[model samples]
Target: MPLALDVLAQVPTRREAVREEYLRRVIPQFTGHSIGEVQWSTAHGDFHWANLAGPDLLVLDWEDWGTAPVGFDAATLYIYALQAPKTAARVRRSLAHILDDPAARVAELLVCAQVLQAADRTSFYATLAEPVRCHLQTLASRSA
Candidate 1:
């Protein structure tokens, strides 16, 4: 499991206190919800489109996988699907079937995910986006 804090540590603009508060609220909800260990047959830690094959959906980039949660890969796929409306709908349906409480869990995780992503200074936000930075700032202010 990627320590949410450790992931956030790579982000430059992160507010530590706010991040801690967010983690404190969410981590407990997953206390006993372990996804167990993943023994990958060549798992890709960065299994995004840039690393995959076009002919068949053979997942590439086996650097980030070791003992990740079962659905973490699926979650990355769903996030990629968000770029396409039709695919996103399919992904949502698929998630609904697999996850017991998908809605609530997704909502909570989205915030944390955004915060984690925002911590990466070289992300799109560092150059192109301001809304995410602004939103994080707002979250920080509210927490303050």
Candidate 2:
């Protein structure tokens, strides 16, 4: 899907699952105080394959729906796609503009940081840590 900027911009985010407090705390852990108000959007808060279905094409778990940082959905999808590199690459390719954006990159880094922070020591998140760390560093340097 193309960047949902115009549509998402019009929708005010009702923060809950990803509240401003969480973002303020998590984003700095990686970004080192580089905080600025990010572009918010109507996000599919939990945008994973399991939460999706075909034919009608629905996004599930309305409990978490709200305004999120512009690229949050794409970043979350990318994070979920990590086990399948090809799929992750496709996600990157499809949403390159959003993921490559400065504000969106911050959104991504925040997502990655939150993932790495809450990761279990001996689980799927553990496996994702290094790669996420690498990406976080790369994004941080690029932004600088």
User: Candidate 2 lDDT, tens digit per residue, 1-144?
Assistant: 434433554576566446777888887874454678767777767777788787776767767877878788888888767767899899889878778877787568677877777677547778777777777677768868
- Worst ten in a row by lDDT for model 1: 34-43
lDDT of 1 at 25: 44
Model 2 spans with C-alpha error above 4 angstroms = 1-17, 30-33
lDDT of each: 0.39, 0.73
Error of 1 at 140 (Å): 19
Report the Cα lDDT for residue 110, model 1: 36
The TM-score of candidate 1 is: 0.43
Best by TM-score: 2
User: Per-candidate RMSD vs. true structure?
Assistant: 12.2, 2.8
Clashes of 2: 1
Per-residue lDDT of 1-144 in model 1, one digit per residue for the tens? 553312422334212222234434443342212222222121233434466675755556655543232234444554454436587568657655332343234322333354345545655323322433343354345435
